[model samples]
Target chain A: MTDAYSSSRLVAGVRTGQQRSIARMISRIELGAPGVDLELAELYGSAGRAHVVGVTGAPGSGKSSLVSALAASLRRDGKLVGILAVDPSSPFSGGALLGDRIRMSDHSGDGGVYIRSMATRGALGGLARATTDAITVLDAAGMELVLVETVGVGQAEVDIVRTAHTTLVVSIPGTGDEIQTIKAGVLEIADIHVVNKADRDGANRIIRDLTGMLRLGPPTPPGEWRAPVLGTVATEGRGIDALAAALHEHYAFLAAGDGLEQRERAMASARVSAIAQNLVAERLTDSGLGDRAAQILDEVYHRTLDPFSAATALVRVTT
Target chain B: MTDAYSSSRLVAGVRTGQQRSIARMISRIELGAPGVDLELAELYGSAGRAHVVGVTGAPGSGKSSLVSALAASLRRDGKLVGILAVDPSSPFSGGALLGDRIRMSDHSGDGGVYIRSMATRGALGGLARATTDAITVLDAAGMELVLVETVGVGQAEVDIVRTAHTTLVVSIPGTGDEIQTIKAGVLEIADIHVVNKADRDGANRIIRDLTGMLRLGPPTPPGEWRAPVLGTVATEGRGIDALAAALHEHYAFLAAGDGLEQRERAMASARVSAIAQNLVAERLTDSGLGDRAAQILDEVYHRTLDPFSAATALVRVTT
Candidate 1:
């Protein structure tokens, strides 16, 4: 197939939400393949429709299960949903690991639900860049909602999760690190707090802790959204309805105010800045300045030039 | 109080290992304060002497205590040691949070020991840059050994920890997420695996698990160093000697071959690249391109242009 003809076909397939086309495009994006940017730019014109919701928490927080349940609930509401399971920690686990695929079995054979997994592509902003790109593909693919799920509250994960219009932070009882999580600044970004596995011991304590913290948290201004703490038994499908309702209410709240537009603008600014930085970094590391970078880095290694000065020199030459 | 005069005094104090000057310089570096670069450049000349060791693990793994124990052991060896405890998660926890200060009470008034804590500065690469800079300050301050401690095995933590010449990955008994840590690529970077709180049940199990996993891990050629899993009750200082021995042995092994030079070169490349990226990000966000970035970002928000294209435009203008 000619390059032009193949690209056009892939674009058409993505427009019609063909799974194969979506997967292929995402693979190319994840690999940082050439010509993908042109295709992504085409898809970007069709995006801005999907309500992106991010789910993140510590490992063993049942994030995957809660996401599955949430997908099932959203599917019940007759909404087209796309699930992006991102594992920034694991390079070995690629798109749709076995566990994630098994979870997708719950919605197997359903046209409304599309599930995919993404792992680390490169160091430093690579995963986030690819994630935003993949979300665009899914958004353009006509999914009404895109759920981005990640398993840790690290800085990288937080940055990824913040791309969502509404973010759900999943927690569970008996983790014994609840206070640390709150202290880690995860509370600030959580549009809704979920205490999963509510049947387990200390579930009420977790709920109570979250409630008390939120109450004591900075007072919500009048007519502004206050994050709610909800309990869930994701495995058994209990409380999934309430969670889904909260998700909708949050989205509605954002829509009712300038919150959605503000979020869009902020996300745009961040994404653009990240892409620009990545472009510059790639130029310095892999392109025209590759040799220069190696020489400058050697100077830094030998202590002949400080890293900051070396970087300044590298940037000067590149710019 | 002139800038030049004060800068020289600070440099001199750092060279002589003055605690106040070291603390002030690190604070300035952490805040990305102006003119800290010149001073850091001077100090960078004196670095590459300290045997930097990094200790990292999941929260509640007794990382802090183990670090404290290791510091004590190193100090007892008549070596000047600097401890930098980094918490990337908490924005509220600034330098020297209460718990960490108390942990340092163990070495209170010990002129040979200096400890500092660092928190998030800004999003994306901020902590890592600040960290590398602070390590320079510590390394140049006549410390024979510098231990960089961070909680969690997230990408951010992993990045910071990898800057060390010898990296110690801490684990504990019964975290129930041990396998996940290995799966997250922590095992690959670990030169020595220390299971803290070894008095707890399942310590043997974790040690066994780590050993078996290591054996099954990629083949280790003859004379290549294999990561050792050791047990330690950090609070009681039990097995501290063994841990210290492992650390020293690893250092000797690195010093014996091209490993030290290779690691240094790799770290230098990473640091310089990160610094260059941060510099570009700052310029785009704060300097000449600030207005242009805003305008381009607005276009992205309106979906008139894709983020990738907007980024390309921004970089084009900046360059």
Candidate 2:
């Protein structure tokens, strides 16, 4: 697998939508194995054709179920789909239960669908980088649509929104009102608002509240896209078609003018900066700079050198 | 105020515990104004004396009330305290409700306590940096104790825990379950577990669950500390003394045998790395390198260059 011949074969296999090759490529990327970059470079040209959709909501909001149903709907349209479930690796949340995989098991034999879960294994910005790379692989693998699902927690949600072309913010009724959802910072990143489990009590009230809040919130420019609140009962696959239509509508909106181009540029810029930072950090750690850092830290601890001066010196020496 | 004389005077005033100077200094730091770094340098020597404590919990968990009660108890022991309330600035949360401030109004005129709220204003890593600088200011202001309270959500909570010497994870009965708390990522970072609103049903159950999880989860090295769960009813002020005692005991444990020294060095290393990264990012953005990045991104977008190669080139050019 480390030889040039094997690498080229892997890339060729991935470009032809071979499941085994695609899985192998993704696994190598996730493990940060050597020589994967060459493979990515070979397959990178085949990407940029898939529409990436991000689905995020608080825990227990049925995000996985909703994403499963959404994938099924996309498949029904004779489209190839890829699903990436981002887990935060929370021990108590049962994020490791493989619930999303189980729910989508029906698509296992379809050959038109692919599913994978990515976890944040204590790497700074590593998950985001792996996710972006995985999306590229899936896109190159001939998937027309890719759904990225994540729990609405911390910086992960923000990163997902930045990476995806369209983002859906999911919520449920009786989840501590509109205020709690807003405080989670997911509302601001939402391109489309979804009230899942719409059959439950207070569903109408939540929709009304969300609508009113959006109205009073930041003013949308004329001719700009306005996020619409939609209701869904994902368990029974209700509203899946409407949701799919809304996604397409959003995509059309992006393609209308310079929106898609500008968005792609912005995303690229973000990715570049993130990778630059990670690379610098990695270089510093891989070299003997840790000892120098410790020495400076000791000086700072002993009040012999201030943190600002120490940091400036460290940056100067390392960069 | 940007001149050296005024900067020295400001530093002196803060060192002498002047409220006006402390407020002004913190405001300047939060704004990231010029000359604040010099002020920080001048005051950095006096900052290591204060015992910094972090209090974090989910929304509607009575975290503010618990912090208020804890502050009163600390003041009763003849210690000057500074309180920093971190608001995530969710427009719907009504962060300006003065809810936490109102609860601590009893100490408003005490002159021994100072409370201020910090809000995230769309800055990358800005909130954490500002919060850390604010703690330095408060520490130099002769505060014997400083309480940093933030909502336990996302990366912000992780940042708070990393910056503080002792961290208290707050929870409430009937809010959810032990798994939910663990999912928040605060469980692993906690130095102390606080179940506020303990009079509610299921408080004991939560304690039992936490205890069981800790027992089965990880093995603590001999002489190292293990987190202990404590119950409290903040409104009634029950268990306040015990909580305070636990905090002191934790402080003693850290102070014994180079523990505090090791922690301080680790913190300094973390801060230096963060500052170095921020400086590199700022330099790249200010150097007209964004256009170069966009050019590379355009190549990547058109499949002329792969993201890995483009990112490597960008990092090379920028750094």
Candidate topping lDDT: 1
- Candidates in order have lDDT scores of 0.84, 0.78
TM-score of model 2 vs. true structure = 0.88
lDDT of 2 by residue, A187-255 (tens): 878889999999999999999988998999779999999999999999899998899999999999999
Per-prediction DockQ comes to 0.47, 0.35
Model 1 clashing residue pairs (backbone):
none
Q: Determine which window of 10 residues in candidate 2 chain B has minimal summed lDDT.
A: B88-97
TM-scores of all candidate predictions against the true structure: 0.90, 0.88
lDDT of residue B44 for candidate 2:
89
lDDT (tens digit, per residue) of candidate 1 on A32-136: 777888898889988999999999887788888899999999998999999999887775445455478678788899989989899886757888999999999
Q: Please, what are the lDDT tens digits per residue for candidate 1 over residues B271-301?
A: 8778878876776553445555667777888
- List clashing residue pairs in candidate 2: A154-B154
What level of docking quality does candidate 1 show?
A: acceptable
How well is each residue in B1-319 modelled by candidate 2, as lDDT tens digits?
9998998999999999999999899889877889999899889888889999998877677888888899999999999999998764332232443486595576878889988877654444566777888899999899988999886545555675578889888888886745566775668888999988899999999888777877887798889989999999999999888999899888899999677887787677666656665665564442545566656767866778876776577553111
